[model samples]
Structure formats: structure tokens, C-alpha cells
Target chain A: MIEVKKLRKSFDGRTVLHDIDATFYTGKTNLIIGQSGSGKTVLVKSLVGLLRPDKGEILFDGRNLLTMTSQEVKELRKEIGMLFQGSALFDSETVLGNVMFPLTMFTSMSRAEMLDRAMFCIERVNLKGAENKYPSEISGGMQKRVAIARAIALNPKYLFCDEPNSGLDPKTSIVIDELLSDITHEYGITTVINTHDMNSVLGIGENIIFINKGHREWVGDMSQIYTTSNEALNDFVFATRLFQDVRAYVAKHGKI
Target chain B: MILTNSLANFGRYCMFLTRTFSIPDRWSVFGKRTIQEVSKLGIDSIPLVIIISLFIGAVCTIQMQLNVSSPLIPSYSVGLATREIILLEFSNSILCLILAGKVGSNIASEIGTMRVTEQIDALEIMGVNSANYLTLPKIVAFVFFMPVLSVLCMGTAFIGGWCVAAFTDIIPVSRYVYGLQTMFTEWYVWYGLIKSLVFAFLIASISSYCGYYVKGGALQVGKASTDAVVSSSIFILLFDVILTKLLLQ
Candidate 1:
């Protein structure tokens, strides 16, 4: 579990995250949802140590991230895995090589052992035959799966994905979402996803934090999301006609 | 304002070098990457080096022959001039200037594309020292391969000059070879090799730095590639002057 306390960040005096506090539980898919420019990306970047927050206590299972030395941070990062929005697979490496990279970097396993583990990850992600293919050889969905396979290759204690469903079709998005959810539950990893995809939010968001203009406006699960009383959250969740219809049906049926 | 910005960038670059020069987390990986970089940035560059040196050597011979067309000047002066030009300057400094366009821009564009695409971020999050992992191999490979390239360039240019002598009525090939052998200070070759090593490091590091800190999208990556080539060329020329003065004196 990761706990953030009073996280404040700004850019050139423009506050982006204003004294935010949140908790991500283990074995759950925690989603950070907000519109574009709502500071969700900044929050995720800060959490992953890509960006330093101005003031905050980022506690990864009680260890303070801000106070840790650079060496310690690097050591701690071994237990952390991230899937970038663009998948970010090394263009030069094949899917198998990509999956084997973290193991190759951090493990004492021999080549055959590493290959076996990488093959296991590839099989787990349902990308058995695509191992020899480059990232460019695969579709976006397959690339994301490859990214996921690589992310979980280490069986990390924490998993962070930045907009994991962006640029993917609806069907592919659901597959990626279910994969993330299943992996989170399977490994009991503290999985945090930064996304605005409604299907993802309603489908797999076990613990959701809705940020509005750099402020946390609402915090709840998908079940409570449809019946939330927050006006800003309502504006965001029902912005589309399909969601509005869902909201209406939820109101009439008293549940979704 | 410009001065302040430049100072800031210099500080940032120093910090970047600090990160890049750190001990690799895995030596085996580093070795593999260094070999890969050598092939990509060094061996692949051989044909271009050969072709350019050949043409430049021929041109140097022809130009020397045309200009030294006087009875007072010895017939061997054309060969001597071509040898001196190729050995003292063209093989090392001029060759690096040309490579700043091909290899420097390549390093810049590749790293810049990785930056814009979040590949570097991915490395960082995986606890890899992205700078060290990415840039060190390129720097080490280029620096080590540079002296070999200088020697090859010198030999190829000599062949080109010999070809000019053999084909055109500039000078006899025997005389040209004699002139190349005459007063050939082995130190001049060492001097060129040393200069090439420094220039190679500059090109690789500066280009990697430009690419590593790239912001925005594909356009910014292109701009970084241009900046890398331009900056590397400028530095190579500047260092050539400094090294020439220091080494020759």
C-alpha cells in the first residue's frame, strides 16, 4: 500500500496539486480520473519520482520517498513497475527482449533462466507467438500487452500505468483494463492507473480519486460513482450522452 | 539573459555528465551495448570515411600540383603538401566535422525520439540510470574507434593521392610515396589520433546530451538533432585550434 500526505506541486508558482492526500490499497485497482489538464498526470509522475513535488510525504508502505537518498530510491524502484501510455517498448528490442530487459538488468538468472521467465511472461500476456516480433510489428493493443508483460516481469509490489487505454479501441481498452485488474488481484500489487477512460473507470476502478482543477473533488468506488452528489464529478461523468443515459438508467433502476 | 541561460545549460550539462559517467549497474549489459554502439557508430561509418578521404586526397594532390607549378618548387612538393594536409588536419579534424553530421545527428535523433516517447522515463522507473545506460556505450565506442578511423582515413587518403598521381600528370607515384616517407614525424599521426579521440567524445556526449533533454514532440527532436550536429561541429573546430596549438607547441 502507498500513502500520500499533503502532496503539493506547482510549476512556476502555478499550483497544480494543492495539498492532496490519498491512499492506494494493495490488491486493488486505484484509478485517478480527471479531465485533461486536471493534474492527474502530474500526480502520477510525482508518485513515480519522475517529477519532484514541492511539498509532500509520499509513503510507500511507510517509507518516505522524499527523504530517501538517490541510491535508496533506485533500490526501492525495483519493486515498482510502470507501463507508459505509449507502451514505450524499446524500438530496437523484440517483444521477448523487451520482456526480458528488467530481468536482465536486475536478476542473477542465467540466460536460459531469463529466457524461460520471459517466455512465461509472454505466455501470461497471451502474446506467445509475438515474441520474435518487434514492437512496430504489432498493433497498439499488442504493444500495450507487451508493456504489461514487461511491467509485471519483476512481479512488482507496485504498478503504475499512465493512461493505459489511450489510443486503443473500446474492445482493446476493455481487454487491457481486465488484464490490469486481473494482474492486480493475482499479484496483489498496488496498481494505480491514471486514465479518463469511462469504461475503465466504471469497469475496473475499485478505488477512484476524481481530481478537479488540481483538487481532489471526490473519492469512491465505481458503484458509488454513478450515484455521487458532487456537481463537478457529475459534470465529468455525465458529459457524454451515453453516460448521461447510463446515469438516467441508474437513477431509475437505483443501481447500475 | 542569454549568458545566464548558457550558464544554466552548462551546469545542467555537467550534472548530466555526472549521471552518465556513473558505474553501470551491470557490466555485461554495458559491454554488450558498447559492442553494439561500436558497430552502429563506428564500423558502419567506415565506407563514408573511405569514400570521403579518397576524394579529398585526390583533390589535395590536384590542388597542390596546380599551385606548386613553378621551377623553383621541387616536384616532390605536391606529394609532400598532400601528405602534410591529410596527416596534419583532414584525417582527424575534418573527418570528425563530417561525422558530426552523420553520427552525431543519429545519436541525437535516436535519444531525442526516446525522450519524447517516454522510453527514458520507462528506464528511470525501472531503476536504470538512463543516461549512463544510453550514452556511455556511444561515448566509449566512438572514442575507442576514433583512432582506428583516423588511421584508416589517412591510409585511404594516401591511396587517393596515389591514384591521382598514377592517373593524372600531377606527379609520379614513386615520388609521391617518397615525399610521404620524407620527414614523416610519427608524432603527427599520434597528434591526429589524440585530437580525434577528444573530438569523438565531444560529438557523442554533446549529441547525447542534446537528445536526452529534448522537450516537446517530433519537431523538437529534429531541432535537437540539428543542434547536436551544429554544436558538435563548432566544438570540434574550437578544440582543433586549441589542440593544434597545444600539441604543436
Candidate 2:
């Protein structure tokens, strides 16, 4: 589990996230949802240590991640995994090579063992036939799966994915979402996914935090989301006509 | 204010460099990376360097022959002049300048692309010291391979000059060979090699630094690549002056 207390981050005197606090539980998909430039990216980046919060306490299993020494930080990071928005597979390496990278870096596994483990991960992601292909040769959805395979290669206790479903079709997005949800439950990992996709929020978002202008506005699960009366959250969530119609129907019916 | 910013950037770069050369997590991994970098930065660069060096040597001989037109001067001086220029400047500084374009920009673009794409972040989150894993291998590779490249460059240039001298009849082959033998001090070889080593480090270090800290998207990556090549060339020239003063004096 990860606990963030009073987190704040700013760039060039313009504050991005302030007074943000949330708890991401193990074995659940926690989603941070907001519009573009709404500070969700900054917040997630801070959580992952890519950006340093101006003031905050990020407790990973009750240890302050903000104050750890360099060596300790690296050791702490071994239990952490991140899937970038673009999937971020090394362009030079094949799918198998990309998934095998973390193991090659952090493990004492022999070459044969490493290959076996990498093969297992590729198969687990349902990418068995695409092992030898480069990331460029695969679809965006497949790249995300490769990224997921690489992320879980170490069996990390914590997983962070940034915009996991962006640029993917609806069908592929659902597949990726289900994969992430399944993996979170299967591995019992504290998984935090940052996204603005309302579909993702309604689908796999077991716990959700809505940020508007660096402030946390509403916090709850998908089930509560459809029924929430928070005006700003409603504005952002139901901005589209289709979602607004769903909201009206749900309101009339009293459930989604 | 600009001075202050520049100084701050320099400090940050120095700190990054310190982190880049730290002890590896696994020597086997590092060794493998080092060998790959060596092949890319050194072995792969051989043909281009050879072609450039040969052409440069040929031109140097012809230019010396044209300018030293006085019958009073020995034909051997043409060979001597070509030898001196090739060894001192052409082989080390010129070749490095050329490679600043070839290899430096490559390092910058690659690292910059990775940064923009979040590959570096992926490495950091994995607990891999990204700097050490990525840049150190290239640095070590350049330091070790550059002297070998300098030797090859110098050898090719000298032979090219010899070929020009023999074919063009600017100087007889026997006389040109005699001129090469006349005052062939060993220290010049060492001097060219020392310069190559320093230039190699600067190229790899500056280029990698630019790439690693790149911001924004593809445009920024391209900007970083340009900055790397430009910075590397400027530093190579500046160091040439400083090293020339300190070493030769």
C-alpha cells in the first residue's frame, strides 16, 4: 500500500499539485482522473519519484520514500514498476529483449533462466508469437502488453502506469484494462493508474481520485462514481453527451 | 544572470558525470554493454575515419607541394610538412571534429529520444542506475578505442601522403620515406594518441549529457542532438588549444 500526505509540486513558480492526499491499497486498481493539464500527471510523477514533490510524505509500506538515501531509494525501487504512456519499450530491442531487460539488470539468473523467465512473461501477456518482433512492428495495444510484461517481470509489489489506454481503440483499451486489473489482483500489487478516460474510471477503477487544478475534489470507487453529486467531478466525468445521457438514465434508474 | 545559469548547469553536469561512472551493479552486464559501445563507437567508425584521413593526407601533400614552390627547398620538406600536419592536427583534431558530427549527434539523439519517451524513467524505476548503465559504457569504450583509431588514422594519412608523393612526383618515394624517417620522433605518436583520448571522452560525455537531460518531444531531441555536436566540436577545439599549449610547451 502507498500513502501520500499533503503532497505539493510546482514548476517555475506555478504550482501543479497541492494539498493532495490519497491511499492506494494493495490488490486494487487505483485511478487518478483529471482533464489534461489538471495536475494528474504531476501527481502521478511525484508518486513514482520522477518528479520531486515540494512538500509531501509518500509512505510505501510505512517508510518515507521522500527521505530515503540514494542506495535505499534504489533498493526501494526494485519493488516498483512503471508503464509509461507510450509504453516506452526500448526501440532497439525486440519484445523478448525488452521484457528480459529488468531481469538482466537486477537478477542473478543464468542466460537460459533469464530467457525462460522472459518467455514466460511474454506468454503471460498473450504475446507468445510476437517475441522476436520489434516494438515498431507491433500494434500500440501489443506494445502496452509488452510494457506490462516488462513491468511485472520483477513481480513488483507496486505498479504505476501512466495513461495506459491512450491512443488505443476501445476494444484494445478494454483488453488492456482487464489485463491490468487481473494482474493487480493476481499479484496483489498496489497499482496506481493515471488516466482521464471515463470509461476506464467506470470499468476498472476500484478506487478513484479526482483532481482539479491541483486539488483533490472527490475520492471514491467506480460504484460510487455514478451516484456522486460532486458538481466539478460531474462536469469532468459527464462532459460528453453520451456520458451525460448515461448519468440521466442512471439517475432515473437509481443505479448503473 | 546568464553566467549564473551557465555555472549552475555546469555544476549539475558535473554531478551527473559523477553518478554516471559509479560502480556497476553487475560487471557482467556492464562488460557486455562496454563491448557493444566499443563496437559501435570504434569498430563501426573505422571505414569513415580511414576514408577521411586518406583524403586529408592526399590534400595536405598537394597543398604543401603547391605552397613550397621555391626550388631552394628540398622535396623532402613536402613529405615532412604533410607528416607533421597529419599527425598533429588532421589525425586527432580534424577526425574528432568529423566524429563529433557522426558519433556525438548519434549519442545525443538516442538518449534524448529515450528521455522524451520515458525509457530513462523506466530504468530508474527498475532500480537500475540509468546513467551508469547507459553513459559509462560509452565513455569507457571511447577512452579505450580512440587511441587505436588515432593510430589507424595516422597510419592511413601517412600512407595516403606517400601515395600522393609517389604518384604526383611532387617528391620521390625514396626522399619522402627518408623525410618520414628523418626526424620521426615517437612522442608525436603519443601526442596524437593523448589528444584522441581526451577528444573521445569529451565527445561521448557532452553528447550523452545533452541527450540524457533532454526535455520536450522530438523537436527537443533534435535540438539536443544539434547542441551535442556543436558543444563537442567547440570543446574539442578549445581543448586542442589548451592541450597543445600545455603538452607541446
- DockQ value for model 1: 0.94
Query: Can you write out model 1's per-residue Cα lDDT over B148-211, one digit (the tens) per residue?
Result: 9999999999999999989987699888888888877899999989999999999999999999
- List the lowest-lDDT window of 10 residues for candidate 2 chain B: B176-185
lDDT of 1 by residue, A50-166 (tens): 999999899999999999999999998999999999999999999999999999999999999999999999999899999999999999999999999999998899999999999
Measured on C-alpha atoms, candidate 2 has an lDDT of 0.92
Report per-candidate DockQ. Answer: 0.94, 0.84
Tens digit of per-residue lDDT, candidate 2, span B1-249: 999988997998899899997999889989998999999989999999999988888888888889987989887887788888888888899999999999999999999999998999888889888899899999999889998888899889988888987787677888777777778877887888899999999999999999999989999999999999999999999999999998889
Candidate 2 chain A, run of 10 with poorest lDDT: A41-50
TM-scores for every candidate against the unseen true structure: 0.98, 0.97
Give the Cα-based TM-score of candidate 1 against the true structure.
Answer: 0.98
Q: Which runs of model 2 end up more than 4 angstroms from their true locations?
A: A246-256
- The alpha-carbon deviation from the true structure for residue B61 of candidate 1, after best TM-score superposition, in angstroms, is 0.3
DockQ of 2: 0.84
